[model samples]
Target chain A: MTYCLGIINQLGIVMASDSRTNAGVDYISSYRKMFDLSLPGERSIIICNSGSLSVSQGVLTLLNRDIQNKEEQNLHTLENMYDMARYIGNKSREIQDRDRPWLEKDGIDYSCNFLLGGQIKGEVPQLYLIYPQGNFIQATPETPFLQIGETKYGKPILDRTITYNTPLEDVAKCALLSLDSTMKSNISVGPPINLVMYQADSFEINRKLELRIGAPYIAKIRKLWEESVRHAFESMPEIEWEQETNDSEEDIFID
Target chain B: MTYCLGIINQLGIVMASDSRTNAGVDYISSYRKMFDLSLPGERSIIICNSGSLSVSQGVLTLLNRDIQNKEEQNLHTLENMYDMARYIGNKSREIQDRDRPWLEKDGIDYSCNFLLGGQIKGEVPQLYLIYPQGNFIQATPETPFLQIGETKYGKPILDRTITYNTPLEDVAKCALLSLDSTMKSNISVGPPINLVMYQADSFEINRKLELRIGAPYIAKIRKLWEESVRHAFESMPEIEWEQETNDSEEDIFID
Candidate 1:
């Protein structure tokens, strides 16, 4: 299991992924799920994948191979973010189709998903969630975010905090906190989180971070967030027991 | 879909459920999912259920029928909480078995789950999550809560706040907040929410609430929690850009 999410705002895009991969409880390991296949100043292509390791790796390999071999149609040649998303989806579908029969024979799942987010020089920055079926949905200004894999535990924070107008740095912080929330609730999403912050129209990612578990900055943020959450919880107004409230109302009426 | 949870602490148990039930997105209605089957001064039994509405209703009907008919092994006759859990599980299995084939023929899911919590005289307060297959797991001192249906969105708070030592009223407040989080993230789970708080050895439940969506108390809590969460988020320490940190380190080393 993995948790990867991308937030797109007017300022730019923030993408984050947890690195833990497990075949089962006993065979746990870490693998970076985020890939910066950016062509630098020409285009910035950031991808985070979740699901079948073989399928995601196969798609990544095909993508990189295309770029390396200067294929006629490749990530670099895609005209816009939508084309790039379709290209990634096609690659994903190709991989899944090739592996589906063999995986099905052993009762294994071959499905995988990708969070594609970045910009081409002429087009606006965008984010997309590519489904396992090779279809994808773009993040609209109204939604402004896309998530794949273990999504729910981390979603409440994102749903509460993100908006299309939120600043890029704040979006990045929200992405990290969302990942932190997921890692706390689910063991399958442990850290050494990969994060990328791309400024709109910049065509270059200036802030890429690999926050390993127990890294000082992550540790500090985690501690601070925990203390803040506990403080907020403690300060919540106490419940007014309905029975007691009803009893008081009756007393008032009688008086 | 529905959202229901039960928390057992040293002082007592807190159980809550959202009331929305839908045949599909177009056909949504409200139905109470929490029931008090307690026989006061003898035992306190509270049940909250989620999943196939028909199956849950059937199980509830059966349990009530048995008690009304003065059956030998009704809820009132169960000697302890564990036996009561098994009884509910058995009843659930019976209902599912009776309805599974017919529901499966229509490609509908016949599965349902129950959160059984409270005291059966001569035993301590307890909580159990009864699975569709009629097997159940008890909440322990270490992990003091059980949840069913649309669970993950609300789980992080419970993971952070719940313990066997939490006060009964605080536990109830946490339960409401947990439900509030779920309701915010999922349309399938809505309110008015039914909540019950059982005091250990009291053999009666006096703090049951049905908090409607527009109820003043629920609205107050929701407003306060949203404000508090926003404040906490705003106060979170900003992320330190690793690029800047490394640059400063290099400058110091060069100097």
Candidate 2:
């Protein structure tokens, strides 16, 4: 399993992913879900992917091969993030088509999804959630983040905090906090993690790191998060218990 | 679809459930997911259920029938919470058996789950998560709360804050906040929610209510809950970038 998140904001794009996968309790292994592609000074792209590791790896291998050949249609040749998203989606579908029959017989899915985002020359930072079938949608002002893989556990934090106008640095903080909550709630998504933040128009990702075991900041965030929920709970009014089954249940509105 | 939650804390027990169910998007109706049986000063049982509303309502109807007929082997005869859990589980299995073949023919699972908590004589307040198969597990200090139906979206908050020492009042607030988050993220779970609380050693539910929809307290809590997440994100550290990729090659971390 993986947890990858991408936020497109006015300043830039922030992307983060965890590095853990397991075939079972005993088959745990590490894999970084964030991949970076850049044509420095002109275009920069980052993708955080989730789902079948083999499928995602195949897509990445193809992208890398295309770049190595200096293909006219590789990530570097794409004029903007949208084309890049379509390019990656096409590569993913190609792999799925090749694997579908065997994947079905073997009871496995060659499914992978990605969040692709960054700046490309004339364009400001943009974000996309690219599906396995090759279509993508960019994040809008109403929805600024795209999360893939084990997404539900970490979504509330993103929903409550993210906005198009949110500061880029704060977006990084939100990313880590979101990761912290997800890591606590789920065993499949673990550290070390990959984080990248592209400050708009800089064409260089300013925030990137691999958080491994003994990351001190993680412990502090966990502790503070517990305290915050406790504090929030202490402030709410306690449930009042005056109504009986026989009483008009509408006794609540009268209160 | 429904959302039901139960928390066992040092101060007491807090249980909440939503009432909406649907055969599809159009055939929506409200039915209470919570049913209480309290023999004041002697015994109390509160069940918040989700999944296969038919099965759960059937199980409840049968349980009530046994009590109505003075079947001495029913819940009132159980000496402790553990026995009560087993009783409910066995009854649920009985109900499922009656509904399964027809449901399977149509490829619909006759799955029903329950969060049962309260007290009987000579026991502290207890909480249990009863599976559709008539097996159940009590919530211990390691996992102080149990949620049923569309559970994933609401689990992180409980994972982060609930523990053996959490106070009962605080647990209620946490339960509501969790429900509020779930409601925002999922369409299947809704209000007006039913909340019930039991005090330890009292052998009776202290108070319960249908949360007044559009109530000032709930509106205030939801606002504060959102503010808390934003505040939490604000307090965490920003991401640190480590530029290791060259512009010429695609960055792939795993083979």
TM-score of each: 0.93, 0.93
Worst window of 10 by summed lDDT in candidate 1 chain B:
B246-255
Error of 2 at B197 (Å): 1.3
Model 1 interface RMSD, one decimal: 9.8
Candidate 2 lDDT tens digits, A109-133 = 6788988888888887888998877
Model 1: lDDT of residue B171: 86
Measured by DockQ, the strongest candidate is 2
Can you tell me which runs of candidate 1 are displaced by over 4 Å?
Answer: A244-255, B244-255
Model 2 lDDT, residue B62, Cα: 73
- Model 2, range B127-232, lDDT digits (tens) per residue? 9999988888888877888889988778988887778787777777788888888888887788888887777887766577676568676788888877766776
**DockQ-based class of model 1:** acceptable
Per-residue lDDT value at A250 in model 2: 30
User: In every candidate, what fraction of the native interface contacts is reproduced?
Assistant: 0.40, 0.57
Per-residue lDDT of A1-255 in model 1, one digit per residue for the tens?
Answer: 899999998899999999999999999999888887777788888889999998998898898888778899998997888888898899998987888999999999889999998998878888999999999999999888889899999998888778888778778888888998899999999889988889988887778788887888777777877777666777778777665442312211110
